[model samples]
Structures are given as C-alpha cells and as structure tokens.
Target chain A: MSQPSHSSVLPQTELTRHRRLREQGSFRRADLDAILDAGFVCHLGVIVEGRPLVVPTVYGRDERVLYVHGSVASRSMAGGTPVCVTVTQVDGLVLARSVFEHGVNYRSAVIHGTVRKVTDPDEKLEGLRRLTEHATPGQWSYARQPNRKELAATTLLALSLEEASVKIRTGAPDDGDGPDADLGVWAGTLPLTATWGAPEPDPLLPPDIPVPAHIARREGTRHG
Target chain B: MSQPSHSSVLPQTELTRHRRLREQGSFRRADLDAILDAGFVCHLGVIVEGRPLVVPTVYGRDERVLYVHGSVASRSMAGGTPVCVTVTQVDGLVLARSVFEHGVNYRSAVIHGTVRKVTDPDEKLEGLRRLTEHATPGQWSYARQPNRKELAATTLLALSLEEASVKIRTGAPDDGDGPDADLGVWAGTLPLTATWGAPEPDPLLPPDIPVPAHIARREGTRHG
Candidate 1:
C-alpha cells in the first residue's frame, strides 16, 4: 500500500534471487556491465498510456549513460518515461535426462531507470556516435556523419545504469536429489555454442578490391 | 498531446519495423508461436508504480493463455497490472563489411496484453501443466503434481496472445547497395546456432541408471 520503491534491493528482488540454483543469480556490478556491453540491441520496456510496452532498439553506452534511439514520434522515446532495458545472450543448453531439470546456460542484464530525452546538440551528436560505434567499434569514423536535418529527425534518450543486476546460469542440470536418479537417464551437458563465421563478399563487389585484414581475421571467433 | 497508440500495422508492431532496414522486421503468427513453444525462460517486462521492470521468468502456454508464475509478492505479477512478455532466440549473426549493414539472424515473439490473474482451479492446474511441459516435453507426467498449498502460495497470471507479433531476421548481409560493396568488404552471415550438449548426470545419481531416450535423442539438436 505504500509508495513502490524502485531500489535494486526492493523486496521483490530478494524473491528472484537464486533459490534452488543459488550460483546463477549475481549481484556483482562488473558482471552486469559485461553482459550489457557485449550486446547491441535490447528490449526497451516502458509503460505508455498505462500499458506496458517492450520495444526492441539499438543501444549505445558511455561510462554511465545508456542511449537508445528511435524516430522522433516513436512511442518508446516519449520524454520523461521510466523504462527498463534488458540484454541477454544464451550460451548453451543445460540438458538433463529428466525434462523437469532442463535449463539454459545464459547471461542476462536488467537495468531499471528513468529515461530523459536528450535535447542539447552536442550531447545528441555524441550519443549517436556512441550508438554507431557500439554496434561496430570503428564505424563512427568510417561512415558519413549525420547532418543537421538527420539529427533533428532522430530521437535519443539517455538513462543512468546505476540500478541494475545481472543473472547468469552456467553449467549443468540439478536432478541429482531424487529417486529419479536411478531411472537410467543418460544425463550430461551437450554444450551449445555460437561463433562468428567467415565474412562473405558482396556479389556485386568489384574484382580488384580485397578484404580488410581486421574484418577478415575476425571470423570464427566468439562475438561477445 | 493525446496518448499515442502503440499498435501498428500488422507487420510494424515493434519500433524497429519503421527503420530503413524494414527487411529485418517480420510479422508471422506461426513464427511467434513456434519461438514461444521452444523457449522456457523469458524476460518479463512489467510496470510497477509508473516504472518499468524486466524480470527473467519461466513461462507456460496453452492455446491462448500464456501463464507466468512468480512468488506471491513479486512486483511482476501484481494483480491486474499490464505486462509485455518476450521470448527470443538468436539463431545466427550477420556480419557485413560495412558496420551499418550488419544484423543478426533471430526469431523473436512479443506479446502485448493485459494480465488476468488466474483464479480458477481448472485453469490454474492446466496452466501449471503447460508451464512444466513447456520446460520438459514429458515433464508434467513424470513429476509430482503441484499440491493445493503450492498453488495457493504461487502467483500465476494468464495473458492473451491475441495482440502478439513475431519479428524475424535471417540470411545474408544487406550490403549490396553501398559503396562498400565495391571495396570488396567481406559481406556474409556468420551463421549463429544453439544445440543441446551431452547431459551431465546429477552427482548423487546411482551408477546403474541410464538416461531416458526422449531427452537423450535431443542431444546436439537445437532447443528453445
């Protein structure tokens, strides 16, 4: 009945803490930052017109500010709204013999904060740069810069990353405690993995040009 | 000044749809269903006291009802509050020489609806079944059913899937029209994938038992 506290330690947070699988839930700051930095797109959760809205968008980050962009009239970018943004990456499947025990090996970050619309010209320019470069490390310098009209047409919101938590699940299933153990189920982790593949050349590419070494060598590597 | 409508044309449900990269957005009801059916854990987006909350949760589904369970005190399942539930699977990565053209191969489902607290005994039991079966295909039959006390302590919300949309991106990079095309920049999709690994037996399991065939056969196959 009292005012709802948005603090990270709200009573509800205590409930979500790893109950059966304690190691999977983390309160560490670095863990949350790492998971968020490795991903570019996030599901932006907000309330519009008393209804919840979860819109996916590209995100850019500075040390403390997380920037998200959309069209000027986009519902997600409505000024002064409180929003929660989440980034998640699934690393593998934690397969168990008993279906009840199956789980996933994943890393996820959830940030809760109030979003403020950016209006200053310099801050807007810098925000777009961060967004572009966040997606591709060297992209801001390589591409054409946004013009005055382009900047005006875009909408950007900056939210502080001070209130957030990281929840991660790694390793195998937890079916060891029951009588079902003797059920003769072959149970072990069949690790699921994802890695970058070779970059293909565009078909219309001119014959003489060659691939850049940095981009070419990045193939077959882990992305985040 | 009036409240902006969040609903869009059949395909443009999410904000990403209006971007220049329209091809990256998709709308198919079946795709949404399949992605949700395949996944167990979901990032639940909710609003509490005008602020947004994205909490990772385990969900189950019947034909129209998507049941979400939480502790009775969870802010996410507050009675009558609106919520958005999203389930996504990133299948592959799209790597283009030009960073602007880079993208990902993914299947994602977004359900936008109001929450109806499940109070009926029949629906509640059925919801629990769907939830357990969703995690493990045959799990409901194998495990002890939830007792009345457990049901009373648990909070379940049934949300309609009627206002949902599926957005999918697949295949190669979209760098065919840019100047980078002539630069011979490597432009192809680095296929991303997820599959089941060998299952690890519970440490306490007796030495004689073997794994079940239904789960055993899923080894190395893609799972939600």
Candidate 2:
C-alpha cells in the first residue's frame, strides 16, 4: 500500500492524472511494475478508421517500454497511432448490503502513448523473447526461437510506460457504516483466484513425452 | 463447437466482421450469451476528449441490451457517446514449440454501439437487478434494493448487443506438424481456471449472522 520509491515513481502528466477515486490511484513505479508483472494479457485500445477498437493481446515489458505483437495485417497493430494498453486483474467482488454501492476489488494499469513498430531485427527478436518469457517463464530458452521469415510475418509495437495510470482497490465494502448497514443482509467480498491446472498434452503427442519441469511446476500455482 | 440456434444468432454487421482469424469467429447468439453470463466484468472502450479510453466496469445483460453503471461523476459513463464494450475470458495458455505459434485459448465478445442513458424508471430498476444478480446469483432478492436518492446518483447506460463479434479458441496449438515439432520440446496447454473462495465477512459483522445460502453455494465453484 506504500507509495513506490521516489526515483522509480512515474511522473504525473495530464493523461496519467487520476480524475476519479483519487485515493485508489498510485504513482509509484514499483506499483506499476507489480501490476504489469502479475499479468501477461492486455487489451490494446486504438483508433482504427475513426473508430475505437479494443483487442486482447499478449504483452511484455523491458524497463519503461511495453511491447505488444499481432499479425502484420491487424489494423490495430499498425504503428504511428496513439494507443491505450490496459492490464487488469480482478482480485475479488465486493458485495454490499445495497446494490448501489457494489464494486470490484481490482488492480489495473492503463498506459497511454503512441506506438512504433520495431523494425530493427535485434530489437524485434528481443521483444518477442520478452513476450514469450513473460507469459511462460523459461519458455524462451526451451522453445525454438522465431526465424527471420516468421519474425517478418509478425508486427511488434512498443509503447513507453511513462504516461501510465495505476489503480488498486482492496478491503471491504464502502457501505459498512452507511444507512443500509442495518438491513441485516450478509455482505462481504468473494475472492476470485485463478490457478494453473495440470497441463493437457496434445492428443497427437507421443505418449512417452512427459511434461517439462518448468510447465509442470506451475500446476496448481496461482496466476496473476 | 456447433453454432447456436438460428433464432438466437446475432446479425453480422460491417463493424462485427471477422477480418482476421475467420476460423475462430462465430455469429451464434448463444455464444455471446455464454460469454456474458460467465463473467460480469467488462472493459468499456470509448473516445473521451479525442483520446480512446478503456475502463473496467461491472455489467449486466438483459436480452439484447447490456447495462453498465457508474457514479454520475464518472467521465466515462456519460451518455450519447459511441462505445465498444469487450468481455474476454481466458481459458488457458497455448504453449507452442515456437514463439510464432504461441497463443491463448479464450472466448471473447466485442460490442460496438452508441450508449443511451436509461430514463425509464421501470427499466432502470430492472437493469440494476440484472446487474446485481449477474455478479452474485440470488443477491438481488437477498439484499435491500437501491433507494430513490441512490438511484438518482447512479448513471445507467444501455448498449444494444446487435453489433457484436464473437471469437472462441480452444484445444491444442497449431504447430504440431510444423518444423518446430521435431525439437523434442514440450508443447501443450496449461488450463487456467478461476474459482470463488470462501467469503470473508466484514470485520464489524456480528458472528451470529451466518453466510447466506446463495453466497455459500458459490464457494469452490468455477468462475468465468
């Protein structure tokens, strides 16, 4: 709950300002990193042909840059346009005594900036590595790296994490002391948690091929 | 999976066209219902002051309309704005032998339309009920409903489900027969499942009050 250290804190800009629920907003760099590291999937929001399109995609972060990839033909992945990348993790559902006060306990980070395609071969390959490893740790070294032709078919865009907004909500409902507290209704939070279940091998795989240790260790472990 | 019944299929529009990955797209109305019923949270995408913003909020669906509410002071909740609401449920992580083939198993729906404020009192009340029960089943009748002042302070906007795009991805990775299959590396899916843990009562609650039956029943149950 403490603010991130000053040196690592993100600078507050016009776009990063918390207009609502200011108490739940955090400007700490550590807080931003924690939220980003906790989840690999993010919704990329961009203006496509004068319309707002939000597409879910996998992402990775290296320092202050966030990388997202999609098919080269994807209109949303085209570079030079401003984008909003959002990563949200719902921790629990807040059930109050009255429907008016209901809310969710979640941690969300939204990054607003212009994205540029990574054309340099080295950075593109490195960006792809970070993305793969971000979703599945140890998979980068374990799997066959993408070849030149494959990389050419993919579009990688990088956005700066400088202008980002982070919001985290926790604890009980806000109506505990309100007028509805006397309603005699049971009210609290129902925590939501996701875990990695056992790996389901491909039906065509050889029966003797056992699951790798890195993948096997994640079974029953919490995700995000 | 087979398509939903003909009577319930969503009509495809220019906006809902499956421009990419046509194989994973569906026009089945039942597919949209299943995706919405499984989760109550959605990301609201809209153009605010010329910039696209994506906000996470709770939602409820009644037939052909989706209802989302926020405080009247919320900038993102204003009416008369064109919006795109997206709901995504991540089922699993597809681990492939090559980074190029890595993907996720998920079901997602993207809704595009202009939002209108709910002015009718009856429909507003019904919409609130759907929102409450959608998050916690049976809670609408269990708890005290919203009062006059509470309802006045809330902004309820309705968006038609007519223009929606559905995409579902399941099963194994597509690189089984590709060049990377001979690398002897592990390739499969790590299923991700979320469940509701035991409800944690408020600290100030009296110990004599037992958890409601409807709430207790959700414990250890799968969440979308």
| DockQ, cand. 2 | 0.69
User: lDDT of candidate 2?
Assistant: 0.84
Residues B173-219 of candidate 2 have per-residue lDDT tens digits of 98888777777877889999999999999776667778999999999
Q: In order, what are the TM-scores of chain A for the candidates?
A: 0.81, 0.94
Error of 1 at B25 (Å): 5.2
Task: State the lDDT of candidate 1 residue by residue for B1-224, as single tens digits.
Answer: 11244223334444324345455455655566788887776777777656777766778987667888662215446566777788877665455655445555677777877788887877888887888777656656654455677677566788877677566777767666765566545555545455565656656656676666665676767665
Candidate number with greatest lDDT:
2
Q: lDDT, candidate 2, residue A38?
A: 96
Given candidate 1, what's the lDDT at residue B42? 73
Model 2 TM-score on a 0 to 1 scale: 0.95
Clashing pairs in 2: none
- What's the residue-level lDDT of A158 in candidate 2? 90
Residue B186's C-alpha lDDT in candidate 1? 51
Task: Give a tens-digit lDDT track for model 2, residues A5-110.
Answer: 3357778887888888898899988889999999988888877666777878889988878999763225655566788888999998888888877788999998
